[model samples]
Target: MRRGTGRRAMAYAAVVVGLALSGCSSGGGESADESAAPTVTQTVTETASPTETSTSPTTQTPSGSITPTAGAPAVDGPVVAQDQLSSPSGNIWCSLEYGIECEVKESSYQPLPKPADCRLDWADNQFRVDRSTGARGICRGDVTFTEQPPELTYGTTSVVGDRACQSTETAMTCWDTGSGHGFRVSRDDYQLF
Candidate 1:
């Protein structure tokens, strides 16, 4: 009986030692759950976002940098004759008068009316005097094109009455008689294109 009590005491001591060793882990440190305990937790929330957009207004002009519109005409004549261009065929007259140089271009190359200096023929949208001593055609002076960069000036005279737009760099003084004849005069550097 005494021997049996001795063996039981030894077994109890071994169990205590085993429990102590288990408390101290293999790395010889306390468990992670005990060391890391949450102290404070913060949550972030976002509100409505602002809208970003451009506030500039749009105002569009013609192609050229500076385009000056012709003021309201004092006389009563259509600047652009839509009615005249309705048919594929119509008569349009352009007369240019520069000092000591004057000419007229018509759709048809008819004989010059009495008192007129000469009669010209229209060829390839251009009318040229068959025989003339001076430099007088329909096109004369400086010209600027809205679609092009470099401006041009013409010394020769040739008729360009059928073009959609007639432009000249030179200044022109124009007056419409309401009749078939429209008067255009250029002085010195003045030109009709």
Candidate 2:
């Protein structure tokens, strides 16, 4: 019995020593200094999302850089009938003086071959429309179109009698509205249609 008690006392001493050296992970073992220490945490939130409001989309017209528009062009001023008009760049001049006609101060197209019967500075610079000669070039010593007419803003159409002329960013076009015959002229080329 004495030998058994001696063995038990040695085992109990070993358990006490182990318990003192081992880590106690529970809150019960945390000291006041460790428990009082603060832990830092960071959180982020976002606000302000982008939003946009839009309506009708625009369409591009044949005239370079021109956006198609609907309804009649806003009339900022009176539109004179049988009046003259120039392109935005003033490179072209057109008139409703006698007929729907236009002329480029400089052009690349072949000038009308001067006829032996005709005496004038043969000019391919001018193009005009008439019922008989749908559209044709002129031989002129000097005439209307190159004479610098009033400015006609793009997207605006001027009508006088059966003739109409419209200036655009890229070209100037004139026609006999009733017959649908016309000419379109730009700096380098012209079309009589």
Candidate 3:
């Protein structure tokens, strides 16, 4: 699905826009990858306590334990999507092939440690989740910010299958279509709800 150049980001860097992010970069397409993700120990607790924590998810995933509390939670709206995406500033990027996987080139918040079972790279700046699931860091050897996919214009969003990602001036917000729950990431911090 990595077959194109990135487009320019729009002016509304703070607004939340949404569209289907196919690989074509014309706001079309769906997830084409289905390899089972590794189990991640990060858990999604329904409790109001953001202090909750756990052990793993299905490989670089967020299903085992963790509460998302980065900045004040703010999920404005949906953004268009492609198989992959770049934030307008090029500081963040994402891939929706398997739910939504995103990473920030730079951030300020301290993230959870790598799940014990994760053998790949585990970082606080790396985020991953399935549609309808809570957000967590990803344990991966690859990155989504390769600039191979189209850029998700500021204020615009990209969605493939059950996932959607929105690029804004402050942070990139993405969520699972079924649960409406997702996470937000930026150069300074991240939040999951």
Candidate 4:
């Protein structure tokens, strides 16, 4: 019976590791690496089960301590919504509404801490919240800005190490294929294409 329990625990661990990997980035070929970067549609599913107390006499010794087998929560972490991402730049922006907070350099924007009103809209062009290169970070998904220009569409994914440009249309969204670093859609014209 103990052996069976251990096998079940191992199976659960494997599933979790698999899920985490599927969301990670790849280097040369297709592989998973979580530290890489996260995309928009990345969904995390958690199932909550009611705590069950075993009535087995032998399992419950006189020590009065209930021993958990495995596959349990080791630490407590806050449950962040999919729209809200905690980037290395120290700013949290709503991927749905307000534009991403990033650094603007040489027509490129990298994630960085900034005020809520990062995008200064104009009739023709949209200025982004300026960030210092010293505080560089990754951009995740490539989303479209239906408002164009002054609206500065967000959601473009550059390669893990390479700096790519965000397109004004669908060119800005990143695929879940696992490109480790997240990126920002910059208004700059410098293209690496």
Best candidate, lDDT: 2
Misplaced by over 4 Å in model 2 are 1-82, 145-147
Give the per-residue Cα lDDT of candidate 1 at 122: 22
lDDT for each residue of candidate 1 in 92-146, tens digit (9 for 90 to 100): 2232322122222233333422324334332222222211211224342332111
User: What TM-score do all the candidates reach, one by one?
Assistant: 0.16, 0.54, 0.53, 0.15
Q: What's the lDDT of the predicted structure labeled candidate 2?
A: 0.61
Work out how many backbone clashes candidate 4 has: 20
Sort every candidate by lDDT, greatest first: 2, 3, 4, 1
Q: Clashing residue pairs, candidate 2?
A: none
Q: Model 3 TM-score?
A: 0.53
Ranking by TM-score: 2, 3, 1, 4
Task: Give the winner by TM-score: 2 or 4.
Answer: 2
Q: Rate the local accuracy (lDDT) of all candidates.
A: 0.27, 0.61, 0.59, 0.29
Candidate 4 deviant stretches above 4 angstroms: 1-81, 92-94, 97-120, 123-193
- 1-76 in candidate 3: lDDT tens per residue? 2211111122122111322222234334532432211111111111112333554564332221122334323334
lDDT of 3 at 173: 81
Clash pairs for candidate 1:
137-157, 138-158, 139-158, 142-169
lDDT of model 3 at position 112: 79
94 Cα displacement, candidate 2 (Å): 0.9
Write candidate 4's Cα lDDT for 14-92 as tens digits.
Answer: 5567545664545444455444333312322121222347766763221122122121111122211132222222221
